[model samples]
Target: MLHTIKQYFNRKGLRDPEYEFLFEPYTGEEAVSFDCETTGLDVHHDEIISIGAVRIRGNQILTSEKLELFFNPQQEMRVESIKIHHLLTCDLVDGVPLEEGIRQFLNFIGNRPLVGYYLEFDVAMVNRVLKPMLGITLPNRQIEVSGLYYDKKIAAIPQGNVDLRFDSIMHDLDLPPFAKHDALGDAIMTAMMYVKLQHIKYLEKF
Candidate 1:
């Protein structure tokens, strides 16, 4: 009921008529797992330097059809942030404008639900522009990999503390070593976590 109310305002606030498709009903079962590499963690001030996402149809991750975009930042990036994403400003010279990148992302994602490790922050970062440009936040459903993992853990250990750390979850799941640490790499890995968790849920029913 709360989501319906919020989505009502989101649709009523539409500033761009062309994006009306975003509000359309989605019958497809596919979802997109995405990640954003920003200049910093501060969504209020930091900028998204790059975005990456992959489509998931059923239990399979369709890596061949993926979206990877880089945005050229007008300002310099901090040293601490560089250590995190390893993306230097010089490497973004070929990137598209930030708005263009966001537009492409919206088109690529369409009405599909979003999946991610820490999705709220990434959505907030994108909404920084989306609200001003289109007067709407992403209306797509969100599936958090960590939240899913937490549900599984808490079911097993209701009183025990659950480690929601990315590395910890990856280790517990026995997933493969994914060393790229880039936006796309993280998205792909998070997709694996989502699919594995879904499988675990199915297996638990028996």
Candidate 2:
């Protein structure tokens, strides 16, 4: 279908053939749950400062093996953003360059499907960096935890609203609130939500 065509073009125009494995059909069950801390919400102009991801295979979350990467933005982060992400420019002074961090991330993820909460923004942020460097965006399939939650939740109350806020969803799922909302912590928590949601059948009654 569309992906098959995109894959063909991506393979044909690949900047580095060494990354050809990315175009390879992923036959594995693993999905990477990832999150990125960024300078701002605008995907057109903002930059990612750090990325955190973990792998989930079947029902198991492999917490022992995880990817946590920080990049040197080399500019002062906005005070409001720093308040939320707690990643100041000073803290990332020794962090790796954006391209290096991105390479490490690509290696860590391979071709696994990606799962996340509000995943579109993060994917957009990564694609902005990836499109120029690789001549293609991530070909990995995406599973949005919030979307899964909505499908599972709206079965009983088709006319009612479902609060899709991160905290509200976590609370409804009975998962523990994260101590602080960093990229890794949020990614891990979102993975938990994904796993739990997979086991829950949609009930007709609330």
Candidate 3:
């Protein structure tokens, strides 16, 4: 089945040879939940200052083995952005360069499916740097925690509308709120959310 999907993507020009390994059969035994703190929200222009990820296996989050990296951005730090992540300019001066940081990140994540809250933005930020060095963006599968929560909430009570805010979902699910806006903190929070969402009463499939 995975081979067929890879063949289809290759024929359609969506598969990059460099990323072929990501299309191999997935055991579904584990996934990585990741988050990034960027210079700004603009995926095309902003740079990632920090990245954090933890592994999830069989409903257990492995906090011991993880990746947390910080990078120096080419662009000057914006005051508004600093307030959010608190990664000051001085703090990033000793940080790793973009290519090296991302290289380590990719190595750490391997081919595991990625999970997070509003995850595409983080993926885009990483890809912006990756395409240049690797000739391909991350080809791994992605899962969004918020989308899962929304699906479960709606299915439980079809007409019931739930606040999708990070804090709101954490509150409703009885998950402890972590420090907001920091990459590692957010990654940990999303990991916990993913575990809880897995147990929610739902449709036939996860």
Estimated TM-score for each candidate: 0.95, 0.95, 0.87
Residue-wise C-alpha lDDT for candidate 1, range 1-206, written one tens digit per residue:
99999999999999888888888888998999999999988999999999999999999999998999999887789888899789999999999988888899999999999999999999999999899988899999999999999888778777678888888888888889588788999999999999899977522220
Candidate 1: pairs in clash: none
The sequence of per-residue lDDT tens digits that candidate 3 reaches over residues 1-206 is 99566556543453345555655657778999999998888888888999999999978999997888998888987778888887887888889888888878877787899999999899988878776676666778889999999888888677666678988888888888866668988898999999988988763231
**Residue runs of model 3 more than 4 Å from their true location after superposition:** 1-20, 202-206
Q: What's the number of clashes in each of the models? A: 0, 0, 0
Candidate 2, after superposition: displacement of residue 142 in Å? 0.7
Q: Which candidate number maximizes lDDT?
A: 1
Superposed model 1: Cα runs more than 4 Å off = 202-206
lDDT of each: 0.90, 0.88, 0.82
Model 2 poorest 10 in a row by lDDT: 197-206
Backbone collision tally, model 1? 0
Candidate 2 lDDT, tens digit per residue, 65-171? Answer: 79999888845677788888988888888888888888899999998999998999999999898889888888888999999999988986788888889998888
